[model samples]
Target chain A: MNVDLIDLGNESRNAGSFVSFLDQICARFELDHAAYAGTNPVASAVHGYVNYPDAWKHHYAENGLHRIDPTLLVASRSIAPVDWSRLDHTEGFEKTFRDARDFGITNRGLTIPVRGPYGDIGMLSVTRDCSVTEWEKLSRQILPDLQSVAVHVHDTVMRSDVLSRALRYPALSTREREILQWIAAGKSQQDVGDILGISHRTVEVHLRSGREKLYALTTPQAVGRAIMLGLIYPL
Target chain B: MIIIVDALNKDRFGDLLDEMFKLRARVFGDRLGWEVEITNGREIDQFDRLDPAYVIGLDDEGHVVSCVRALQTTGPHMLSDVFQVLLDGEPPLRSATLWESTRFCVDTQRLCRDGNTMKAVSMATCELMIGSLEYARRSGISDIITVIDPVVNRVLKRSDNAPYDYVGSTKQMGKVPAMAALLDCTEERINRVRAFAGITHDVFANEDTVRDLLDARQLAFAAQLGESSEWMAAILSGSEEALPPVLPEDIQDYCRAQIETAQTEEEHAAALRLVAVLVRERVHPAMHRLVFQS
Candidate 1:
């Protein structure tokens, strides 16, 4: 099913239309259920919508199923469309799966993981009750559409914090920030090593980790990004 | 195809573990002259019992062509236990999110030809790497500390997914010198390997499929060479079942020619054993040259 793309710039208006958009998605796909869950690990905020039986979402939140839900676990780590059946059936999961089934969440479904620009993880799962064979056929028909729609839904409906979060920039250690600051102030790697009382190779390691944290392409870029992020100040 | 195996699904790995251990012996004990303990033609150690995750790359014929092992850094790891000499007394780095990747090797005979480059080797190596990064990223690991030799280091750089930095100074580990190298477990790293390999799709197969494909190949080989001949019976016995992967056509022809040229029963048996191993583990095209020369 298709819904008109809402203007994300109008935050309040977009927020209000999100439920209708989700409803349209379920209606078009003939899906019995749908959900869009977002987790900003940096901010420790988990919020989502699941059009399941009443209070099920609240119960799931109260129980903190987000930490152990196999489907969400896979969605967080992979940029893939995880078939619900492919998840691990570990301790405590059988009950979760059975309880979900009790709520009309079938054994067969698909969850498309969306990694946001600021490193937030979210997923859009559409579920229906059907035999494995029928589910496979339906999946083949709708997978491409579902993947595109998942990304669209995540971008449009999910709250994004691009400027502040920068997609969860890896938190740099104090020493790492200091070394990067020195590098930004025209110090060579060897110079930093001498100043820090560590080996030059150790300095290189910190610098490399700094670059990786900032997702920088080189030493210069890493230093520049560090300064821009206020992780370090220039001389 | 690449397969991911951990303690949970390792039971479905079939003959791959045996093949990997034998290959390790060949590379470490025979070729590199490492001081590893090899018994019954297999190089296994205490680490194998630790239930480390394995990323195995198999050729189209179901032969394992490349393999690497990963262990949680928070637990006892090879670098922490045995390779302490390399660490220089620094406490082994441990974290819930950091992993140790070790035992990285490619079947040079099968993949590389002129001891330089081959399409299969490059593809297998890159695929194995992609598999490792994907596995790590999904498991919430943020970094990988691998005790890699210089040759592997160069290969990683060549493949465009080099380690971000080295952790310790180089030290001699058996015949080859090695260093602790660090690679960030990130999608960007995975993308680099994927782009270099020109792969755009997932390369992983479920554990059962891997077991079935390998079992079917071995059963077919058993059917082709029934346990009638004494030599075949001896080599194919359960105690000595470390036979190589199914042989290619040219190598089969070469083995037949060598068998015909045998002058005695003992010579024939020796030639048969050598031929069986050679066909299964031919890492390079020039291996025949070394065999003929010797």
Candidate 2:
């Protein structure tokens, strides 16, 4: 394999440029598709650009497949790139793979996990529809370069203004933070309200607002997010 | 003494690896302020997950004083991934016989804490150099492409273990400028570092002896911490509430070793206090699952 050094220094910075970059990578490496997903540390939300079909994207989100997507769940936790073949064909995998095959997406893929300084994780997943032997050869040949590309994509996305803003901690009021901290320390809503010299209903209102700001569904989830973002300390 | 920790034997040296990560956190995260992830007072990154070999130096009390990470160049490495800017427009070096050495650091505060001069640092540095080169030579590795700062580059020259060649120009990385230097894994280079450090005997620690010593220390620490063998067995057998969910088994093992080998009463108390702080903070969410699963 004639591997040439890839230069990303001159790549244009724009909203659609990431898609173009992924398209270029797919073309150069003879891949069917390339996708990049980065988790925003502050909100714990995932956002990225992918070259897969929009129909598949909508299907994936609508079905909440990310919750069980081995490429994301298993790959994000690992320090190394995960080969799709190495993942077990569990019930979730079968569902995802069966659905993906209908969209002409093969199971032969690799997901390279990139960890940033502040505990953020970025995954670059690429797929190729080819014979098993061909995929093995191609993956082996491109693994090193793909790893570097994964980091480049991650760093670029992390530096973007949108991501930077998302990375910023949600601004929580002092009272709200105190309430959450107390709640995390096993205080009840009434106890927090009493400690803060407020009504229980007012405490509930503050918890609701904090939960909204953190994009959490429950008070405990909001408290967890607050603790993770360093907005509140755990007792 | 120098010890090589790789994937095969990493389980046996979990405590040493943890200390090495903490040392890296101090050097790269705290002192240098590099864009590196630090969790639970340890600096660990994606590359560390790839099972890279670590050449570490431990003091008499088994404190990890100096360390460097070596990764196979054929796989993804710092030079190709994080520090590609230093490569200019050139292709990243990839070869089975060439390893990329990076994250080279020494615990300066610990080594020089007693008002020791540069002697301790230099000795440790030379010992590491000798250790990595000899290990590489034995493993059939031909050359090492290291990403080093200018200060380390100068030290390499001063110790007469300088690189034979350079690749790509230097670029400012984090708080310091870094360049890639290539060093051959040869007897001549090893001899130069050994001669410079005046280390004639083997620098590698005897694995069996080290394990025995550490095991003995762990027992002593358990006794001093008021934890009996029965308590340890209970914890090991999954006694609820005895061990905190946030404390991973490996970290608990490491703390046990630290308490056992502590030189002073204050040191032993400090180790115990650290465990308290960790349990209180519950700093790492990932460690929670590890504890529960273990």
Error of 2 at A137 (Å): 35
Error of 2 at B179 (Å): 1.0
Q: What is the lDDT of candidate 2?
A: 0.74
- Cα TM-score per model: 0.51, 0.46
How far in Å is the alpha carbon of B289 misplaced in model 2? 44
Worst 10 residues of 2 chain B by lDDT: B227-236
Write down the DockQ of candidate 1.
0.03
TM-score of chain A of each: 0.59, 0.63
- The candidate 1 chain B region of ten consecutive residues with least summed lDDT is B236-245
Tens digit of per-residue lDDT, candidate 1, span B28-87: 788777788998778888877766678888877687788898865434578768887876
User: What would the DockQ be for model 2?
Assistant: 0.01
Residue A20, candidate 2: Cα error in Å is: 45
